[model samples]
Target: MTIKKWFKSGSPWIWLNAGAIAISMIMVVGLLSLILVRGFSHFWPAPIVETTLTQPDGRQVQLLGELSRSQTLPAQVMREAGVDIPSDIDLVTRHLIKQGNRDVWGRDFVWYPETGMDEWRYPKEAMRLERREWGDFYGYPVRLKEEGRTVAEGEKLWPELQQRVDRANELFDEIRGIERGDIGAVNHRMERVRLEERRLDMDRRAGRIDRASMEEATVELEARRAELADEYAVLQQRLDQLYQDVRRDTLVGRVMDGREVEIPVGQIIRAVQPNDMSVVSKVGLYVAQFWDFLSGYPREANTEGGILPAIFGTVTMVFVMSIIVSPFGVLAAIYLREYARQGPLLRVIRISVYNLAGVPSIVFGVFGLGFFVYFVGGAVDQQFFPAALPSPTFGTPGLLWAALTLALLTLPVVIVATEEGLARIPSTIRHGSLALGATKAETLWKVVVPLATPAMMTGLILAIARAAGEVAPLMLVGVVKLAPTLPIDGHFPFIHLERKIMHLGFHIYDVGFQSPNVEAAQPLVYATAMTLVILIVMLNLTAISIRNRLREKYRSESD
Candidate 1:
């Protein structure tokens, strides 16, 4: 077939492969875009309750909450339900669940957000709250009643008032039943008093007034006193229970009474702004900065989204790795290309370099831990920086060690790329340069290296992209989840190379899973992840641009 005919026939397969690749790229781009947009959007201004509450100590605190009411959900709801709970404010939740009131369970603040109900993870015995300090710091908001007003009116009293009604009913039931037991006991005692009175009357009527009957009358009176004491004890118990129920706020009981009172659940009061422009400006800036950092590419902790540290670490490590590996790789490539005889030994060396590339990265991580960090770095630090001692100064995982390890790991790629670029140069060009009074070393430095730097840079860029995103190895070496201090700081020389640093890659893993507050940490996780992907793209783009420029510079020489 003719060349044009062959080109036309191959177009279908080319289009198919290109279309598949395009769709995949679109999908990847779309997912990353969504994560970036949503993660940043969370930091935008959200509605919050604004109030300045006065504490018992006469100090005002600015508090923020999602609910509208100052009278937050009352903790006394437990007591109102006749639940014999402990005094621990913390333990109050368990008994609250035990009461099984739909309003308390469904609408209470404690566990509503996490568990969607009042069910508590901790047992009542394990929970404890300081009693004396438990005022507004503890219960539903009960604003101080005015001089004239005693009962809080409307929805505010609904929950607590219902509690009182329940208390009254319980007390009424016990009081009404007093005749069944205590009243009977009282009656028995009263009978003894009557008998004593009758005996005394009978004796007097007989004109004898017997001493035995008078003594019996006194004994009968004592029996009546004992019966009356028992009835009083029973009545007192009922009154105490009534008093306990009355103290619980009315909101809980009222809510249970089928009242649609908007009981404050997660109520928090914050300071209200007095419409000042300066305050508005500060608020605006805070919101804008928050969104800006979250939306951008990954950086160091001290920068926007803290992606700068990642970028600096990644580029710095790669440059160091290339510096360490390039000379060694280029030397080995040169020996194979120009000096080495085509023997079995040379072929074996070539095969070994290729095999090294295929070794699992984790194996390198293990080797770095045992050989490079502990053995080499420990010896260096032991001899030099002893003040930062015992903590494995150079003997630990760090930028220097990561650079060296990756250099060894990616050496074969540099070797292969350099050798190929060398081979591509026509033998005639080398001969002509040497013929013009240039030695082999001079020709290499002046001619070959300049021509091949672009391809070598390509190999280095690939090595960098892989190293920057590495995590499993970094964790083993030195990427701590929480470093007490940043690796870079302002002290004398400024960059604290000895200090452990935060990495964007590690930050994503730590914040997403290991953080104390998962709800709050999730946005940060997505923001970091989005930032990292963007960074990798940027590094690769730089490498591509360099390659294009060199290809253009050298294209004319070949023709």
Candidate 2:
């Protein structure tokens, strides 16, 4: 066939589209593979290398670390950089070692020339200690201590150290429970009591307070405070006991330079002798660490631990936005497609919605802040939550407002999709239903809307995909660096809409760009981004499954 004939037959366009799709798929697969490799590999335990190196100035230094990476450079460059490379060699190799005793080494990573290294060995006794602060410690366990007194030494110290870590973890759990659980509940109750008193005071100033009621409230408040004070004292005692127990134990480790340092057992997350681990043991530890990353809360300025809060918040916000946007979007689309007259107003509305879909997300965020938070939320707070005045409750950035804002931002997509679905339904079916004496509403709901359900779900899926990855708008609306509590909790009226939340996308942004410890936070960024992508995929899959079911169910009815 001639080129002109192929073009006219649309074969050229089809081939072009296929090529574009293949390229897009390859790019996406490649990106996801890179993320997976970088993220999941972080949990694996690598053998610690202990080696001696000859410095360029003829001095020898001892080093213990993990071989992180290697690179090759021209011999001329190495000599020019004063690296003492041999003149005969065309290229020189150097290794970047992750000597992670950052507190002692002054740096986490260091580059050493291969030519200057000697006596490389992976010591079976070498240990890697993951700490709460000061980064990881690469050393050998010397002894176990209690309040500066040695309790165990040599081989016995390893088992003792493990036992103490387990004990310290338990104590840490108790401390967290007291501070964030029991104490948190007490604090919330005290805040409610304070707000109640302030409400009564305001009523008195306005000459609307009842004397008997005011006296009863005052008595109740005093009794509650007294009860809380007693509970607080008991919690304080437990906290003191935990601190004492935790601080008593310490692990003494000998570094590369043979400098012995004492690290409190409570401050260490895990102490692993990577060089001593068998394959099965290493695999088990790797799985455990990965699971911990999935379920744990972040620490050390979000450079360590897991992002459970972010995952919860992202899922909750997307679920809420889907719930809110679906009905409104479907209803508007139905009116435009089924009920509204074909006129200039309908055309204008369609144009407006499509335009809205193209509007910047940040612009939506600003609008949400101004109109939803400052205006609507402010009014609600004034009328109903006046007790918490001055300190705005609903009139602030929160999960509810974030969900609502995302719903508004993604509404246009739903409207367009639903309208297209409705338009695609044959008019003969509606006419047949009407001819059978069915009312317009009955015909539309039973015949037309049912067939269009799949399209509505398709729109919802798109909206969820878009909203889940959004960080810019959420930053302005409700997403924070850290959330003390989730939006949904055990509290009464369980879904607390007026609470700030952490989001995976925002967490990635913060850890990648805004964290104080950039080097430590870099890997976490990839991990978080991978997690967010997984979450979005799960949500879309659910929506798509529902859409598929609906389509199958309505296939015969539409025909």
Candidate 3:
């Protein structure tokens, strides 16, 4: 009767907890799946080729990207990027044209076909332009006659311009390879080696050799050096100007000037490369960038930058901290459960653990910044990385500090879980092992810890999940907006601890809030947000799977 009552009373509470957990799992999973779908959607879209036709009549047929109106670009877009135009001549109009300029329909691309460069969906890699029959009229209409201009004159200019650009680019590449003093460095070093030999020769024939001949040799060398140097400088300057014209990123006007007009992240990033002209290509670029944004972590120097290195930096620091904290947390839990006297002190320690858990993550961030970044890191840098000092490699918020802070924040959770797991093993288990002549240490290693592995792992997974989502602590410690270089590479053992890093949370915040072009960045921000959510969900799913497996393995049939 007592057993029946206990079972009946516990059933409702058990079902309630299970239901809550199930609901939460379903909600999070569904939301994350939706986000992942949307992010991936940005990739594959229908492909269409755009063209133009000038019939035997003077009428120009405009070929849009597709028959129906496309929300996509190059086909019906009136403004190819910043080049604005007539509002009515938009994507819908292009769709009307692509419908074969059908007389059956009042509006269509065929009747008034136009494959205008002005509304290019994307900059085509190669425009198959050749002298071909435009329905039988075989003449360049804009060509400049003896003293006249015709319809074909403008048409020929693009091919000519392309040729010139190719030649110019080739020249620029060659000249850029010529380094300052490269020729002279080799010559100068050789001269130094030959100086002693030359001295002897000169002494032997000082009067016999003409002074003018020596002067001429020196002048010739200098002239050759100056000629190469001038040619290189000119080519470099031209390349720099051309690069600037293409990207148009520097509102500075001069290299050192500054007065930035706010622009969106997508706009700026798109402008960085011409290949990002197509909708598909643009989508691809963003996906790759965001993937880097999501997976690697990101950071910047001051305000605007990426977060890949920061993720790397954070993970490295935390992994090290885990190695440091795991033993300490476990040992403390063991002593408290088995060795420490159970008294007021033990109760006070428990209270302290609770208080520490409640302390804000940002507080840990601050402490990490102050103690770990500054003092300990400063000391290490001063002793070993003296060359990089005053820049504050360790002594400012950084990876090491962030790890330590998170470790501190998570330590209590680990300790509390470990203690609980240790306590949960029936007293009989311990007594049974000891009764069989096993030492306490042997029991812990062979029995207690083994049975408690699942609980300990649960605590660890929770700690990791919490740490991965941590933003405030990172903000205080090492969360930078952008970083100049990657933290990992191959250079004499190769992990660069001094570098800053990026995080996805920080990236979404930057793109959504701090981006220069807020309007353009909106879609990308949603996309990025979706990506981050999917990643966090993936992590949680892995943890939950492990937990489920353990629960199935350990659940007692009697219970």
Candidate with the greatest lDDT versus the true structure: 2
Query: Local error of candidate 1 at 485, Å?
Result: 3.4
lDDT of 3 by residue, 1-559 (tens): 9878978889878988999999999998887777666555533332334445444344554343332233434523445553333455544222332331122233323323243323444323312111011110101112222112221235464444344334444443443343323433444444443443454345447674466766665666566667656765675676566444433211110000112122111112211222225676667756665564444322221122233454455456556556666777788888888789999999999999979989988889878877888789889877765444455657666555666778888988888888898889888988888999999899888778767756666666667767766777777776677754455644434665555565556656767788654433444455666755555566667767886776666556214
| TM-scores of the candidates in the order shown | 0.53, 0.95, 0.54
TM-score: which is higher, 1 or 3?
A: 3
What tens digits encode model 2's per-residue C-alpha lDDT throughout 507-538? 99999999886767878888888888888899
- Write out the backbone clash pairs for model 2: none
RMSD (Å) per prediction: 29.7, 2.1, 15.3
- With candidate 3 superimposed using the best TM-score fit, by how many Å does residue 102's alpha carbon deviate from the native? 36
Q: Candidate 1 — number of clashing residue pairs?
A: 21
Q: Rank the candidates by lDDT, best first.
A: 2, 1, 3
Please identify which of the two predictions, 1 or 2, would achieve the higher TM-score against the true structure: 2
Prediction-by-prediction clash tally: 21, 0, 51
Which regions of candidate 2 deviate over 4 angstroms? 1-10, 74-92, 556-559
Query: Which portions of model 1 show Cα errors greater than 4 Å?
Result: 1-12, 47-287, 291-319, 385-391, 488-498, 547-559
